[model samples]
Target: MVDEASKDGLNALAQAAKQAPRDSPRDSTRRGLPPVHLWNPDHCGEIDIVIRRDGVWMHEGSPIARKELVRLFSTVLRKDPDGYHLVTPVEKLRIRVDDLPFRAVSLGREGDDLIFVTDVGDEVRAGPDDPIMVQTDPITGEPAPRIHVRRDLWARIARPVFYELVEMAEEVDGQLVVRSGGQAFPLGAVA
Candidate 1:
């Protein structure tokens, strides 16, 4: 459980994230992504922020309603070996993720490529760089599908979108595979 002081710290971090500039001159010069991967900030400790399975950000048992704040926080999100952390230039704070951090809410197609739009508005094209993977839940035997977004970050494909993928799937080597960017991503075995 998170203490009151930690909750206050999380609030401060959220505030800081909100105030951070999104499209500054320096950012414009960079073609894609802030170098969160290269940043080795000090661990400020874990905060009482959780990203729920349904894509809700919660702090101190309350939902964080500000979409811009959520978007800003998403920008700094990094998933390391230990778990997920919200990283800044100076500090990194651990946050709880019930499942995956982002959810792929919609899908589109550009010729042979499959484009996925995440809840945070990140557009991911599934290919060699970003591949679709589905893991079967051991207990429930359900498929948990995900797509790589950027640099080890992934978005859990929502069920409806997964259904869309199913519609596009074709049999390949007795496996249900979806073709995108001239690559075949196996959704699962034909059952």
Candidate 2:
């Protein structure tokens, strides 16, 4: 159950997120991301926000249904030593993340670069700066692939997107690899 203070905090966060200044349009790809890394506000406290493994943002035990609101809040998201937090110029509140905060829902190719679209609308290009990494579950041996989205933030590649990548992979030195931004990323050992 959520306490009254928690509820108030959540409401304040939502309001602050909505009221935050946005100079650029809502296009994640074309506009510049908010400079959340530079903000060092005092840690206000914890808020009842959870980003599920499936990339759904939950607040006070309910899913936040507004897509625009989700996108807006995502701009202020930052990962610190303690955990993920929603940061602004004045306040910073820790939030729980079950897994990575974003999901790579779509993949496309632009010349030699592989561009990924995250569930929240950020477009990231895989390259030396933002490389792709895959980890196999020790117990299940299932491949879990992720792509670097921004500073200390990564997006889990969805199963379907991973499959698409596999279909585009090429055999390179006994490994299935994909090239993007002039770099080769290994999918796995050729099987």
Candidate 3:
């Protein structure tokens, strides 16, 4: 069953977590990432882990409460056409992501730059490199907003945080746009 698989996967995750170096992700702006993009290690296997839409990391059919471990694993996370996977020097394990892998928990403004703090404590500033995008569900027609963190990874802006963004939006060309780093990112139409 999936439960058994999750248990085995958790053990692997725990072991892998220990191997991952404890580095300050807060300094990502100054230093580059771990070069997961460049590392094309062979796929080890699938891991029975799933990141829920609410930003919960589930292992062994239970939520992973260790924030530090989650942060460490996040460093190796990569996205490809197949799906999301956690990569290391020796192996790579595929993991299920119901939505985005991260959630934007808070937001701040410094001058013209907008900074977002993810649940795992990743701070990203919106600019040309990282941009905010809003996608409307085709079936439900509800807006789902996400902000790019690094490479191809994105953090879904939490609903309450999205409300704060809506409050800060300005009407430009009949579109709701928020300015950050002197760049304007359109949320959607002013409906």
Q: TM-score per candidate, in order?
A: 0.87, 0.89, 0.87
Instruction: Give Cα-based local distance difference scores for all models.
Output: 0.85, 0.88, 0.85
Worst 10 residues of 3 by lDDT: 16-25
Candidate 2 ranges beyond 4 A from true positions: 1-8, 18-30
Superposed Cα deviation of residue 62, candidate 1 (Å): 0.9
1-191 per-residue lDDT for model 3 (tens digits): 34666566666766764565544558667243466776688998888778999999987578888888788778788998999999876678999999999999999999988999999888999988899999997878889999999878999999899999999999999999999977899999998
**Between candidates 2 and 3, which one is better according to TM-score?**
2
Residue 54, candidate 3: alpha-carbon lDDT: 95
- What residue pairs clash in candidate 1, if any at all? none
Model 1 stretches with alpha carbons more than 4 Å out: 1-11, 15-32
Q: Among all windows of ten consecutive residues in candidate 2, which has the lowest summed lDDT?
A: 22-31
Instruction: Give lDDT tens digits, candidate 2, residues 72-190.
Output: 88888999999999987789999999989999999999998999999999899999988999999687799989999888899999999999999999998998999998999999988
